[model samples]
Each structure stands twice: as structure tokens, then as C-alpha cells.
Target: MPQITFLLPDGGTQTLEAGDAPTVMHLAIRHDLPGMPAECGGQLACATCMVDVPEDWRGRVPEASPDERDMIEDRIGSLPEGRRLCCQIAVTPALDGLVVRIPERQG
Candidate 1:
């Protein structure tokens, strides 16, 4: 299983072992982590599952799809520099030590 580190809004960190969760949003919802309500579940319709991919990890993770970018940039307005919809990020073995920052609030 891979491991994921969630940087909370309070400046704390939660590291979880990714079991069968398909995406980062699923992991957050499964563990009931704050800052990620994921009201729309894993669907692309909701921007509630936003997370910030640190600069170092940007190269490793795939770029956001066109739909995701449009949702964030056009609909949600300006977010953090590395803002990404966690729903679009697959939980893969290669992301074992992935670290993501949960914004203070979600759209």
C-alpha cells in the first residue's frame, strides 16, 4: 500500500496508508479528514476536493485535465498556486510518499 500525507489547514499533518481508495479525495472522505468535504463524492462536478500539490511533487503527478482546470480557474476563481482537484489524482504506488496541502476552505 502507498502512503499519503495530508497537510491540514491548522498546520498539522496526517499520514495515512492508502489502501484501496482510488483517488486522494476518496482517501480524505474515507478517513473523514477536514478541508475536504467532497460533497459530490468523486465526481468532477464538485470543487470541494481541492488540494495543493507541493512544487516538488508537481512533476511527479500528472497535469490536471481540461475539465478540472476550467472548473477551478473559471468557476472557483483563483486558488492556491498548486491547487488541484484531489478527485482527479489517482492513488498509485508511485505516489507512496505523496504530500498534499488541504486548503483552509473548498469551493
Candidate 2:
């Protein structure tokens, strides 16, 4: 199993052990972590799963697909270069101990 750590805007953290199958958004929802609504159920059409990949881990996560890229740019609040939709990130053993930051707001 891989471990993921979500750093909430309020300075809280939620860590979970997940297998290499679930998407990051699914992991968040499964653990009942705050800040990721995943309103579109992992579809690229919604950006509710937006989160910022920590600077050091930016290039470690997979690149966003075109559709996800466009949707994120249009709907997420201000973000850094590595911001991405969590739903598009597939959990993997390599992502063990992966860390992501929840933005202050998402719309």
C-alpha cells in the first residue's frame, strides 16, 4: 500500500494507506478528508478535486492530460505551477508518502 498525506489549509493533516489502484481524489473521499469535493466523480469536467502538489514532489506526480489541464485552469482558484486535479492522479507504490496541499478555496 502507498501512503498519502493531505495538508489542509487549516494546518491539519490526513494521512492514509491506499493500494496502488485508487485515484488521489478517491483516497481523499474515502478517508473523509476535507477540501476535495470531487463533485464530478473523477471526471475531467470538474475541478473540485484541485490540489497543489508540493514543490519538491511536483515532477514526481504524473503529468495532467489535456482535458484535465484545461478544466483545472478554468475552475481552480489561484495555484502554483504544479497544481492539478487529484482525481487524475493514480495512486501507486512510488507515490507512497506523497504529499499534497489543499487550497484555501475551490470553485
Candidate 3:
């Protein structure tokens, strides 16, 4: 299992122990953390799972898929370089201690 740290908008952190299967959105919802809506249940159609990857780890993560990129640009607001759909990020041992920042707002 890998541990993930979510930095919430309120300056609080939620640590979750997630196996290498569930997406970050699933982990957040499972732990009842705020800021992640996961409204479409991990589907890229929704922007409710949008998050910002930490600056230091920006390029470390894979580039967003075409579908994810399109969805982010169309459904979500402007896409920052590190912005990603949480549903598209799979939990993995390599992602242990991954840090994600929840955006202040979601549509």
C-alpha cells in the first residue's frame, strides 16, 4: 500500500493509505475528505476531480491522456501545467506518498 497526502484548501492535510488500485479521488471520498467531489465517479467527463500536482513532482507524473486533456480544457477551467484529473491517476507503489492539492472551487 502507498500513502498519499492531500493538501486541502483550508491548510489541513489528510493522509490516506491506499493500495495500488484505487484512484486518488476514490481514496479521498473513502476517507470523507472535503474538496474532492468525484461527482462522476472517476469518469473524465466531469471536472469535479480536478487537482494540482505539486511543483517539484510536476513532470514526474505521466502526461495527461488526450481525453483527459480535452475534458479538462472543455469542462474545467484553464488548465495549469500540473493540473490533472484525479480519476486518471492510478494508485501505485511508485506513487507512494504522492502529494496533491485540491483546488479551491469545482464546477
Candidate 2 lDDT score relative to the true structure: 0.84
Which should have the higher TM-score, number 1 or number 3? Answer: 1
Which one wins on TM-score? 1
For residues 1-107, could you state the per-residue lDDT of candidate 3 as single tens digits?
A: 88889999788988889954478888888887788888889877777898889888776677789889888888765678888988898887878878999988875
lDDT of 3 at 43: 70
List the candidates' TM-scores in order: 0.94, 0.91, 0.90
Question: What's the lDDT for candidate 3?
Answer: 0.83
How much is 57 displaced in model 2, in angstroms? 0.8
lDDT of predicted model 1? 0.89
Q: What's the lDDT for all of these models?
A: 0.89, 0.84, 0.83
- Give the better candidate number (1 or 2) by lDDT: 1
Off-target runs (Cα >4 Å) in candidate 2 are 77-79
Between candidates 2 and 3, which one is better according to lDDT?
Answer: 2
lDDT of candidate 2 at residue 64, scale 0 to 100: 82
| Clash-forming residue pairs, model 2 | none
Cα-based lDDT at residue 92, candidate 1: 95
Q: lDDT tens digits, residues 13-106, model 1? A: 9999999999998998899898888878878887888899999999999899889988887656775578999999999999999999998978
Cα error of candidate 1 at position 78, Å? 2.5
